[model samples]
Target: MQSVAEFDNVGLRYGTDAETLSDISFKLFPGSFYFLTGPSGAGKTSLLKLLYLAHRPSRGAIHMFGQDIVTMPRARLPGFRRRIGVVFQDFRLVPHLSAFDNIALPLRIAGIAERDLLGPVGEMLSWIGLTERADARPATLSGGEQQRVAIARAVIGRPELLVADEPTGNVDPDMAVRLLQLFAALNRLGTTVVVATHDIHLLQEIEGAQMVRLDKGRLSDPTGSLKYPPRPLVLRS
Candidate 1:
């Protein structure tokens, strides 16, 4: 089976500054769950930016969904990004849109009929336990509520790849675990999940999840798993 994404000696720099990420290489396979861990200023966010196509690396290659995204035409990026979902640390929800609309944005962008959206959107609202807050705008929700809405928005489309940055940072331990379970559930359904987090406890939440650690912009594979091709994963309950 084809890998969902592959990074070959990837390096990223901003302007004339030193590379924010260097010699980073990894492969994320379909149905696999990965935990990206590091201390503060460890280039976690920069690497995630590269993963989500928010920025191109200064050097090295990145292939996703079987295509070289670095050289892909800019005009084509929006279409490609639709296949990937991202949950930002900032919970970038639209201020003007209510929770339900924010979660439904992707489907609407894909041209799903208005009638077809209510079921999925409603189910996602229910899943996040925000059904009562569906009409609330981002400003009206608490940080945790906003975070859940952001998560629900990201996964509602069920993209092939899901990338999250410090996804559980703002929630209590129980909510954090619940969010991880949501990601695990998505992974079980075959979405490749990569979560960049500083929380080490989350690493053990999903059995068989691979780990990739970063420090000062360099990659380290403590488990030595990144060197080989990934096998089909069977996540344990």
Candidate 2:
């Protein structure tokens, strides 16, 4: 299978002395659903930030959609990000915006037509059981409802890759199950989904999920390929 994203001996350092991620590497295949599991502050969120183009690797290389992310121009970043959908741990919705508008933000930014936007947004909202709350503001909605809105918004563009960070963390157990089902359905339709979470029970119940466990910035399974290998030099001095 073709790879959607790859990190080759990637390391992320926030400052001069601190290294949050050291020599991490993994390949996310197309149409695969992966759980990025790790304890708190294990660089799971940092890794997602790299995947979504929020941060560039301090060492090594990351390829997204066949382009080298470290060297990707700032002007081109938005276009690359458009190819991916990200659901943040915090539902980063605009408080003043209506639920419909929040879900429609991506399409609107992409300059989609009004008529074309309504159908999909409406359909997705209904799918997430948020149809009646379309006009409600984010501040008025419950946590689960906001989470569903975030999911709907992220998947609104039918992006090829979806990276969700702790998507089910705040939702009830039943709602979490429903959200997982929704993600699975999207995966069937060819979206490569990577969900980062600490909920082992929830992830275990799902069948055929490729689990990528991160420990202190290193991947556990498939140790040989992803055990924070040393960066490859194009040519030794």
Candidate that scores best on lDDT: 1
**Collision pairs in model 1:** none
TM-score of each: 0.95, 0.92
> lDDT tens digits, residues 81-194, model 2?
998999999989988999999999999999999999999999988988989999999999998899999988999998899999999988998788888888877887888888
Q: How would you encode candidate 1's per-residue C-alpha lDDT over 116-149 as one tens digit per residue?
A: 9999999999988999999999999999999999
Error of 2 at 148 (Å): 0.8
> How far is each candidate from the true structure, as Cα RMSD in Å?
1.6, 7.5
Runs of candidate 2 with Cα error greater than 4 angstroms are 222-237
Strongest candidate by TM-score: 1
Total clashing pairs for each candidate: 0, 0
